[model samples]
Target chain A: MAQNDSNTKDMILSLNSIEVLYDSVLLAIKGVSVEVPRGGMVALLGSNGAGKSTTLKAISGLLKAERGKVSRGEIKFDGKLIGDILPQDRVALGICHVIEGRRVFDHLTPDENLEAAAPISMSRAKIKSEKERMYEYFPRLAERKSAQSGYLSGGEQQMLAIGRALMTQPRLLMLDEPSLGLAPFLVAEIFGIIQRINKEQGLSVLLVEQNAVAALEIVSHGYLIENGRVVMHDTAGALKENSDIQEFYLGGGEGKNFHEIKHYSRRKRWLS
Target chain B: MDWIFLSELTVNGALTGLLYSLVAIGLVLIYKSSAVPNLAQGALTMTGAYVVLAFSHNLGWPLWVAIPLAAVIMFLLGMGIERVALRRLAGRPIVMILMMTMGIDIFLRGTTLAIWGGSSRSVNLGVSYDPFFLGDMLLSRIHIVGAAVAIALFVGFLLFFRTRLGIRLRAISDDYLASWSIGISVERGVGLSWGLASVVAVATGVIWGEVQGVDQSLSVLLLKGLTVAVLGGLDSIVGAIVAGIILGILESVGADFLDPFVGGGSRDLIVAAVLILTVMIRPHGLFGRHDIERV
Candidate 1:
């Protein structure tokens, strides 16, 4: 509610100082405010357990599954206050979340997994066209679509996950750690396809990644979340050039002893 | 030692096994979507039969009207059980959910006992009790009808799993959070599963209630269903059908041939034997976990 109606109207998703509590005890996310404009790509970049995934879960209303709740703040999705909406209804409202790890249905074939991800109310023809569209974007998936998804390569599984998310025809697609464990080439290819989808279909994306360098390359705006707060929110260029980000995240730091000192100093600097 | 009698036993046993498959299918559906072993399936089955009896006998309705009516009631009751009983225990350990199902079993038993009293009741679906000869083998029409119902359910499920909704339900069983992430309502999937489980319970109840008098012993049918579901693999529909047939033949053949030597009842013992043996050789059951978790 901090922003006026006009200010928030164009945004696909806006989180205003939201706080997340796990199991009524652990404070995972502390007053985090993030937004993705309609049809824009944004990245929330952080290391492990930095609340990046938690924020995504908060918006998607998936926190309920984990006994986590957004104890404070309002989440507005597509100009509606959606903080209390159920996760499935949020998907109906066009918020599809591709959670961390390549969590495809391993028992099913890649083709079946895509079909499963389509909205339950979708027509068979629409499912067919959307599947073809997914195959077009991730041709590697189409080649292996008939095979068991569990046997697929890590990169292909990642593509399948993204393809499955797109099957929902979501307006805002939130992906958590899509590039983890993939080769640099595969990550680039998948990220490039995601960028294309965002561009061509006006599908807004909120990508959470530990690979800040690659994420920054594709996304327009980047938020640096450390511990449980957003330390830096800026244009991708500004983030890529930030000294702290360069040293800590982009691997500019050197020496094991020096790395610990820099980590301590960086934490202090970010916190202050 | 008669060839015609032995042939009759074999074919009849397989058809009788279809009834076991009928009951097992409900267990498979619930376990597939929610990963919860519904211990109350037998209780629901007994209750379902009595509900039908009340409608058909007490209310003087026809079998056609009573059967579908009881199914709808059981379906809604199943969903209500999910919402009121199972939903609260969502993120709890599997053992806790398993225990909740047992509590549901006990609660339902008490309710049925209090309502219907201790005496057994007969539910005549008006299916001709007359035996017909197929060539040299004599078979009951009930088993044939059971086979027909089982086949219909099998085909229905086969066509269903191929659909998008069925895929979504299966995905929930695979991973709940992921299913919810993509907008698949894990609640609805689990709730629908409970409803289907109850509907199948009604089907089994009505069929069995017609064959054997509906009584307290009907709850023992859970053990038979459990044996088939476990031997077939808890989550596999095809496994349930195949295992049910195998178990059915073993029971019928054993009761006829083996029971004479061992005094009286050995059917329950045979089911327990299959369960122990299947668990020993294939821990996941015949068709469960089709893919060995790739290292």
Candidate 2:
């Protein structure tokens, strides 16, 4: 417990060598560790099947719902051990996970989606004001406030998903693939809002993204994972300049055909 | 064919449909939140009637006091059922939880039989037995009161769905993980839905008992409610009410005109036929959202 307090004072969330398993048979994440300092934006960058989403789910306590369990290591949130806490209670502790695929309640209208995500402990007045604040941040949401979320375009749904997370007034927001299936302009717009929110509200963020270029552009710190293991961690600028990241992730390598690419090879050079 | 007789039959059928709507709405509440078609609903209805009987007949309590007491007891029983039996099965396969509900239903029925005995009992609400006349058509005051109460409850249900709690319930129904990630306790939400459904069950039982006597067979009324629920779309509250009324009219009118032709008991046959047709044509049922995939 004394050791727990040492690292968490500066970090809003800390994952210490956590391992996640699905169905008690399939290991999805192996010995992963990551952290988000107070009010800092950290990006977890990896391609599909790289365990980026699994790490985020572990922190938000959503692993159980998917038959995925954190089998090893500790997750400390705000200087307290939180691996055993329920996902719903994690929200009360101010950790919100905007899950992958912009999972807005399709049946609910945009405004009602915000209402559903409002923290149970918040007063009605606070909820109302928070809703207004959301509309102010994404004025397009105000235009389609009453439309069913399922009918919204991908970009609008992404905005509503973020707005829903904001409704919880979380201290740490864990977003999984926010820019997936969005237009480039929409990605920039959404990432800009995320940056502004982190800057203005001082909210810590742990963003998991396959789109490393977009994510690295906004995040202060970045970690690159391959096959469930963190191969590299550095400041976003340093990561952008790293040879392996530039060669494989940023598509700047000298490979014209797929076979010559470093990532196409079975072995990862960074890990070796 | 006398038009007056037809009108009376239609009006009577509509009133009976309202009662079916009340029971179906209870089914909808549990089904919507938990995705379990609570098979124990029949036993719950039986238990509710028995609770009222114990308070009113056995304890010699007044009907007014007994009804509320029975409702309170059943509500807690519903919550206890969720917490003790259903909550443990959360995230389990739908079929497994459904089977558990069936087991619960059987257990509750056996308990009812052991405690209440197998005798039919009348519930006297102390209302006047006078028949009200609409022109030449005679209407029972009890039926009128039952219809009024059912409508009032339906209206109350509509208002509930518009409240914050209702929105949360809807959110859980739509996507359980999304609801949990948003900080809504899916387990507690499901438990509350069960409790509220039981309260509806109690109201239904008391009103139903006032018209038909309270008996073990009263549990069979759940089959009619199930029919309404299936025809209306299992998750749609409005669909339940509409389907209930339609079923009532069909049963009443079918019993009147087709019973003799079909050698009696055509009401059940008619309902089964309609249910089959609805399933074949619109599997989502009236007012149910069709799950269309947008590629």
Candidate 3:
């Protein structure tokens, strides 16, 4: 609700010169800074081990544990300095990190999984209303509420992870490789839900992805990271059209050539 | 052979089963949260009984003042164990932690020997109520009250698990990193779990003292607690309680009825057999989530 609706202008998260190192030798990310305004999706694109995941982890406070220390940097979320804050405290300050691999609480039922992210103190009606609204966005989750999260399909599990994060009512949601290991149809479905969450709920997102073409289509702004530094920062459209991006990521596909590939992306439109 | 005799035996077994459940349930709580088999649990229970004996008998405190104070002291002791022993070793392999707890058990047993001078000490609550006769049977009032308290504590624990804090504990058991990320204070929760387990141990010790008298050897009751926990399921509170009752009843009834034919003392053998069967049938124990390994 703090995000802009009509004009759609607000600064939700600001990373000022974050330098993340792993084990004092492996520089996962260095001297990177980016701003994600409210109510829009921004993609951090990179290859495997290119520090895309590391950047998201730095913001979420997960990277700090893996010797991925933020040696010199500051992370400000919703006007608060969060670099020294504990991960759980960061979660309390309205930043939800949907970790990669859809790592839900597998022992819990889907409803209990959502309930885990519920604030330590809340009235019953407020909890109910928020759950109802989340169900509206993800009706499939409602049907599977009684099922254990471990039993869900990959796409369903991804939906449950996102829905559980939404339960906390975060201002900025940072998702790491949400499209990993999903069928093409589920990936597109997830992206569609991400777009809706931003537009309707006025949520801001810093999306990290290995699937460059798919991620570029969903977000407004984009950054390319390689070995712990940002190499490309531009509008999503510009990144999509960059010749190097096409050669390395999109397999030399131009506007005309993109129509011929029959892969996971095509399956979303034709198969499902 | 008489019907009246059979009814008396059934009531006695049921009473004993409730106390066993109290001790075993404590083990289940610790194992579920920290994944360590507490070899020190029996020692802790024995320590609680000895603490009460010292306060009421050696130090001249009234029974009313001694028992609750002993339980509180033991609760603090349990928290100390968590902070000093278990906290540093969390996330280590299960075998090493088990060995550490075993070492704690040995240390506690030695301390008990050194302080109590390896001698038996009489523990009396000074309740002067007479045993009442029903038909051909006599039942002591102390046993009845102890059984009632144990059952009540078990019910209270079931309710605690339904509250928000209880759910948070279960979430930690489900996934540690995920629970921490969601704002559940893992260190605080672990400490509280240890404290609760200590309270249960004190209750178990008091009842055990009443039934079997008190001595340094009374620490062996920890073995019974471990057996119950293993049979019931290490991580399941309901399973631990149920298994405790079942094992207790089995041992009591076996000693009473079958001892005549099985050379007069095979109750422990029956318990050992049941434990083997439980482990073979369900390694995770009854009600425990089967740990599914994915590569």
Q: Whose lDDT is higher: candidate 2's or candidate 3's?
A: 2
Per-residue CA lDDT of model 1 for B188-277, tens digit only, reads: 789999999999989999888878889877887898899899998998899889988899899888788878888978877888899889
Tens-place lDDT per residue, model 3, B1-295, is: 7767677766766666667777788887777665567888888878888888889988999877888998889889888887888776655577888898888888888887788777666667664468767667877677777778877877887788767677677777766666655666666677778888888877777777877777766678776777778877777778766777677678877788788888777877887788788788877776777765443
lDDT of 3: 0.77
TM-scores for every predicted model: 0.94, 0.94, 0.86
User: Which lDDT tens digits does candidate 1 get at residues A1-272?
Assistant: 33567867889888888899999999998988888999999999888998999999999988998899999988988888998789999999999999988789887889989998888788989999999998999999999999988889888989999999989889999999998988999989998898888888898999999998899999999888877787778899988887778877888744344245335334533224
Ranking by lDDT: 1, 2, 3
Docking class of 3: acceptable
Say which prediction, candidate 2 or candidate 3, comes out ahead on TM-score.
Answer: 2
**Candidate 1 clash figure, as a count:** 0
Question: What DockQ, between 0 and 1, does each candidate earn?
Answer: 0.67, 0.72, 0.35
lDDT of 2 by residue, A17-136 (tens): 789999999999888878899999999998899999899889888888888999998998988899999999999999999999888988889999999888777799998999999999
* lDDT, residue A204, model 1: 96
lDDT value, residue A6 of candidate 3:
39
Q: What is the lDDT of residue A148 in candidate 1?
A: 86
Give the per-residue lDDT digits (tens) of candidate 3, residues A15-100. Answer: 77688877787766777777788777898887888777777788878764455678887887876779998778888888888888
Can you write out model 2's per-residue Cα lDDT over B1-295, one digit (the tens) per residue? 8999998889889889888888888899998776788888877887898899899999999988998999999889999999999887888888999999899888988999999888888888776788789999877788888778877877888888888999999888788888888899999999999999999888888878878878787788878888888888998888888898899899898889998787998888987888788889888788876653556
Cα lDDT, model 3, residue B146: 75
